[model samples]
Structure formats: C-alpha cells, structure tokens
Target: MALVLPFEPNEPSIEALVALVKADMERVNATILARTGSDVAMIPEVANHLISSGGKRLRPMLTLACASLSGYRGDGHVKLAASVEFMHTATLLHDDVVDESDMRRGKLAARKLWGNEASVLVGDFLLGQAFKMMVEVGSMTCLDILATAACVIAEGEVMQLAAAKNTATSEDDYLAVIRGKTAELFAAACEVGAVLGQRPKAEQAACRSYGMNLGIAFQLVDDALDYGGSQAKLGKNVGDDFREGKITLPVLLAFRRGDASERAFWQRCLEKGEGNDADLDQAIGLMTRHRAIADTVERARHYGAIAKDALALFPNGQAKDALMEAVDFCLSRAH
Candidate 1:
C-alpha cells in the first residue's frame, strides 16, 4: 500500500513550506549562529556580514522539510540542515569574491566590506564548521553527499569562469555550469534527508531528482530575473549578469537568434566587456525581441513540471505540497 500524507490548496507562495518546517528551522537557525562563532573576531564578523544578510534560507529549509516529509524523527536533521546552510553561505562568499560583486542580500558584499582575503578565509572557516557538523551527525552517507556537492560546486565555479565572456557558450554548456554550481547542493540537501529517514533507495533517488530539477528551475528563473526583475526582489541589482559578462540562457538564446548587427552588439558588450549602463537596456531590448527571457521562463516551467512529478512517489501531504509549491515560488520570482 502507498503512504499518503495530508494536503490543502494554497496560494502560490512558500508560506506552506515555511509553516510546515517553522520549528525545525528555528533550530537550524540556532545551529547556524552557533557554528559561525570563532576565536578570531573577523571570522564571525565576515561570516555574519553575509549570513545575517536577509536572503531566504531556502536550502536549509529544504533539508528540514525533506526530513519531515520522509518521516525522520531524529534531531540529526537539524545539524544537517545547518550544515546545508553553511555550505550555501560559503559558496556565496566565495562567489561574491570571484564575481567581484558589490552587493549581496541588499548589503555590501563581504568581499567589499572586509577585503577579498578575509572573505575567502571566512568562507573556508564556515566550510570547516559545516564539515564538523556533518561529522557530528554520524551519517557517512550524508557526509559523502555534501562533500561531493562541495567539490562539484567548485568545479561549476571554474566551469563558469572558463565560459565567462565567451559568446559561443551553448545551452548544454550553460546547463553543465549551473548543474554543478547550484543544483548539486540542492540535490544533496534533499537526498541527505531521505537518507537520514532510512527511506528506500528509490525514494531517496526521487528526492534527489526533485531537488535537482527544482534547482535547475530556480537558476533558470534567476537568469531570467537578472534582466527582468527588480533589485528588491532579486536582493541584488538587476543586469548584474550582463555587467559581469555572464552568458546566461536568455543571452544565449538572444545571441543565437539575433542578426549580424545584434550579434555584433553582444560581441562588443559581452565578449569585449565594453558596455555601459545604456547597453544593459539595449540587451534587455534584444532579449525581448528574441523572446529569450520568455523562453527561459518557459524552460524553467518545463523543469518545474519535472520537479512536481518527481514527488509522485511521496503521497500528497503538507511536506509534498510545500516542496511542490517551492517550485512555483521559484518560477514566480520572475513576475
């Protein structure tokens, strides 16, 4: 007999997920704060600069919610959830330094405030603490999952760097970059929960698929929103990707669809890195003409459908529904 949980319809929001895991999230929050502490003042200071920044703690929440949904009762999920967040924060700190980002979660980036060296060192500190928490969980499976995710994420960063400012990047190339950079951790976060719950191998695989597809959808929407959404919504300035010469899906599609003049414009702005603020507007215009942003959102919707289907094995329940709604939330960010 298949197991069935509970469910109720709600608006397109993450409120359901947040409400479902509110208690566990509180513990995750505490663990995050506790782990951020170190004898060196700058460690906590730099870590907190980004950690305290008001980005949605969605990755940790995904860990907690997946555990609850998997019927996990032990407290190990808390530690794992905190570890998940620490990994995400560490990535963001490193990414900001690498991207030369000016803002994060609407505040000055840690690299800007504390210098790149401090930011990188503090990021390493958080990663070390994250591993310590994983060890305390005593789950070798969980440790292996996160550790591999860390490596894949680093590889993704390097991949993105290699692809940077190159107008010839393909959709497959971009997918490879995002899969490593963003989706791997999300997959690990959800899979570890199923592992902790001692769910069957099939169910564990299903959870990983859900997180992976959801993460791809999440990043696709982010790429769309980089040119289409507001800073208030994105927690960073719009067109930052363009300014950084990132060849996202929207840009790829637009570049592929554009004429010689349009291609030359992209070559100058992206390949040559010689654009100004006005070029951003022109890039958006070109994207609009090519339906690039629209198609990117459409691509996200395709993954979102897969994400929802990935949960078919888990009966309809609050956890299931919340996880499903998170896909909607990711897609909705573009609007």
Candidate 2:
C-alpha cells in the first residue's frame, strides 16, 4: 500500500498539508530562528522583524512536502527548507527597497522603520546566512540548484528594471521577469527536496516543473489581485502595481486591445508616470472593459492545470493531495 497521511475533509486545504508536515516544519522554524540570530543588535532586530512577522511560510512548506512525498527520512530536508525561506525573505527585503514599497504584511515596511540602508544590508546578511546553511547541508547538487536560482532571481529584477514604465513591454518579457523573480525559487525549493529524498532524476524534474508552473500561476493571480483583490489580505493597496507603473499581463493585454485614445491614456498615466488615484480608477476601468482580469485568471488556470499534471507520478497520499490542493489555492486567491 502507498503511504497515506491524515486529513479531515475529502478536499484538502493548504492548512492540512501544512499540518502533515508539522514535524519537519518545527525543525525548519527552529533552524530559521537560530540562523537569523546575530551578535550585532541591529542585524538580528531587523532580520527578526520580517522573519517573525506573519508570513505564510509556504515556500518552505513546499520544501518539506516534496521531501516527504518522495520518501525522505533524514534531517537534511529541515536545513534545506530553512534555506528556501531565507532566500525568499532576502528577496522581499531587497524587492521592497527596489520597488520603494510603503507597506508589507499590513505593517510598516522594515525599510520605513529602519531605513533603506539597513534593509538592504539585512537582506545581504540573510543571503549570507542562507548560503552558510546550504553549505552545512553538504549537498553540492542542492547548493548548486539554489545558487543558480539566486542569480536568476537577480537577473529577473534587472529585467523588470529595464522593462519598467515601457508601455510596449511584451507578454514574453513579463513571463521572463516572473519566471526568474518568482518561479525560480519555487522550482528550487521543490527540486531540492527531491534531491534530498533520493528521488530519481525524472522525479526531480517533475517536482521542479510543478513548482515552476504553480509559481507562475500564483504570480499571475497576484497581478490580477493588485488591481482587484482585498487590501486586508494583500497587506497593500489595490493598484499598487499601477501606481508603480508596472507593466503586468493585465495591463499588457488591455494596452494591446484598446483603442488609440485608450493607448494615449496609458501613455499619460503609465508611460509618463503621471498616475493619480483617479488615473488608477480609470486604469481599472480600462482593464475591466478589455476583460484583463478574467483573462489573466484564465491564463493562471491554464498553468494551474499543468502544475496538477506534473504530479501524476506521485501516488494518492497526503503530501501529493496537499500539493495538488496547493495549485488550486494559488488560483483561488484571485477570487
């Protein structure tokens, strides 16, 4: 018989998958706290501020779930999961700095409280610690996967910088940006679990594919949500991306499909960076007319289906089911 863990409902919740990995996650959490500590008062203070804040820890949980699903029975998965979280946190600190974002997780951004210099340095400190943890895990293959992902994520940021405020940014350009900044880590997080679990090369590739597609879906939904999602859940204002002049997929589609006068409106607000509250309202209206939100969600569902299919080799069990449900959860957030 295949391995089967417990869940209360027929349909699994992401919370249920989280529960299934509670034991491993406990170790990962401990590892995170221990690694983030520092003798310098400010390093620990700034790092812990974001680490302790109520982030969902989903990426790390993916690490743990993939390990368990592939029959991992050792402690290496714990350290690897912690490394994934550190990578994510480091990126968040740096991203907020780059985006000049005002809020995070419904609170004052660490940069706001501690200043930009502190935030960037703290982010660097987290990356250093994350690398140290990866080295200690003693899996060069895992280390190589994560290190490459880090580089790709940086490249993605640079790509976004190049594309920013360019109304002509193509859908392929946007895909490349998100694939690096968002999906690469998700891919690394799941791929490393297979490595630690001693899964075959094909299984490892499958895990990576699953994570990559799911991450794409997740990001697409986020793009939609930024224009239409509830701020209470998002911890930021609706149209934050628009205010920043980001050329997300929704805007890309609407820009391409709109009339000449509509293109001029986009040029005035996004291309010229003259956005105001009323301008954002108009942008949302334009997206609505062009069916950008619905289309984006439709694209997300397409990727979500690919993510589901990627897990076909895995047996019906708690981890597999949870991971499958996770694909649904990523898409559902837009609703």
Candidate 3:
C-alpha cells in the first residue's frame, strides 16, 4: 500500500490570494510561451511541463501575501509574483541537472525527459526571461535584490558541493548554506513585494527576514522527511540524500553522537559515498539513537517561530493571518 499524508486546506483568505496568483501566473505563462516563439516550441513544452507540475508555488504566494498584508492594492503585484515563479522554476531546472534527480513532484524531471543540455539551456532562458520581467516591472531596487539573491544562491550551491560527504559540517555552516541556496530567493520574493508596495524600509526588511527564516524551516523539514517519510508521501525514493552523499542536519547530529563503531560505519557509507540496505538501516538506527530527527524538527520549529515573530510588526489582517498560517503549515506538513 502507498503512504498517504494529511494536508490542511489553506485559510479562506489564502484561497482568494491563491486564485489571484494563479490567474496572474497563467497570463505570465502565456507571455513566456509567446516570447519563446514557434521555432523553439520545445522550449515552451519543457518549461510548461515543469511549471504545470504540482507545486505549492509557495514563493510566489509569499510575494502576493506579503504585498497584500502591507496594504498593497495594485496590479504590479501580479508581475512581481510571476517573476518569483520564473526564478524558482529556473533554479529547479538547473538543480535537477546538478543533482541528477530523475523525479520531481512525482513526475519525471525536465532534464530526465528532455535531456540535460535542453534542460540547462531552457533554465538559462528562464533566468533571462525573469530579468526581462523585472525590467518591465521598472523597479531598480527590486532588480538589485533579485540579482544579489542570484549570486548568493550560486554561492550556496558551491558551498554545499564543498560540504558534501564532509560529516564535520557545523550547524552554523549548514544554516549558512540553507540560507543561501533556499532562503535568499524566498527573501527576495517578499522584499520585492514590499518594494513594489512602497512599504517602509524596516517593514520590508522584516518581510525579507520572515521569508528567509520560513524557507530555512521548510528545507530543514524536507531533509527530515527524507529520513522519516515514506516514498509515497514524499514523492521520491527513500534514502536519496544518503545515496547522493549529501550531509544534512540529521546526519551531522548523528555523526556527532556516534561512538567508535557507529562512526566507522558512517565513514564507510558517508565518507566513501557508498551504502547498501544494511548500511542505511545502521545509519537510521544511529540517527534514532542520537535523536537526530527530533533535534532537526526542533530546529525547524525554531525557525518557524522566528518567521511568525517577524510578522508582529505588521497590522492584523486576513493576509497577515494567512501568512502566519503558512508558517504553521511549513512546520506541520507531513511531507
């Protein structure tokens, strides 16, 4: 039997916000397809395949939610939200190629289906398209934030590559990598919304901080799920990070807690980048003994609380409530 996880419905206000974002996304997608042209039809196809795949679209939704919470009532939010989605999609395309991942959202990855060369080129094209959209939005400040985020994301990827299979990675180092690779763009999304809304600089910074912390919590929970969640619920195979030799929070904690014999087992599997079922069971057992999964969950909850605290500066409203709900949702999601 396949595993199933529970999901709560979004808050009522979130439903309305989601509708607006979806309508805007369709328009933006149309614009992208038209710009790509008929001669490059495959580009649109591949792009659409990835775009239409079922994702929470959390980043773009964050842009919209933040803008609305700040009393923004303008059409420009749509374009800005679309820009976030484009940037996110571009990153996913490139990440799949880099990770050699075959599945995403329970579907074949764009790189796996269309080949890595096509995927990378399309990813670059999306990045260029995102910048073009930013220019059209006509906010120099927004552009600067996004451009800087792009650089930080690249740096984070490099940092992760260096940290891979290195069990000595500290919690602080892991936080830095997660902030760059995952949270920076999320921060940029909300920050751009504040810029568009002409919000106060301090409030804008708060929104960015909220997004950043929420993103870190989201990714941390994701890493924990890899160890604790079933494949049917997670939409991917079990022990994927183990197979890829990626050292995440649980593994780091487990290593720190391990004794001599347990440490030797990790050295063979993690250091040498090779593990079988028995090795995976041993690793899981060691992690359980160390209570690493619970520790990671505590870390995720801490960030989620920080995210909620960041919104305290904003006035109470349905949008603000929905934003708070999103933080709760991130911490509570089963997969």
Would you estimate the TM-scores of all the predictions?
A: 0.96, 0.95, 0.91
| lDDT of each residue in 1-335, candidate 1, tens digit only | 98887777654899999999999898888888888888889998998878888878998888988898899999999999999999999999999889899888889998888999998888888899999999999999999999999999999999999999888799999999999999999999999999999999999999999999999999999999999988888887888889888889999999999999999999999989898899999999999988999999999999999989988999889999899989998988888
The local lDDT score (0 to 100) that residue 17 gets in candidate 3 is 48
Instruction: Give, for candidate 2, the lowest lDDT window spanning 10 residues.
Output: 7-16
Error of 1 at 284 (Å): 0.7
C-alpha displacement of 205 in model 1, angstroms? Answer: 0.5
Candidate 3 lDDT over residue span 111-209, tens digit each? 888999988998888888788878888889988999999899989988998887788899899989999999998899888888888899999999999
lDDT for model 3: 0.83
Worst 10-residue lDDT window, candidate 1: 2-11
Q: Please, what is the whole-model Cα lDDT of each candidate in the order they appear?
A: 0.92, 0.91, 0.83
Superposed model 2: Cα runs more than 4 Å off: 1-12
Backbone clash pairs for candidate 2 read: none
The TM-score, computed over Cα atoms with residue i paired to residue i, of candidate 3 is: 0.91
Runs off by more than 4 Å, candidate 1: 1-11
Per-prediction CA RMSD (Å):
5.4, 5.0, 4.8
lDDT of 1 at 318: 92
Sort by TM-score, top down from the best: 1, 2, 3
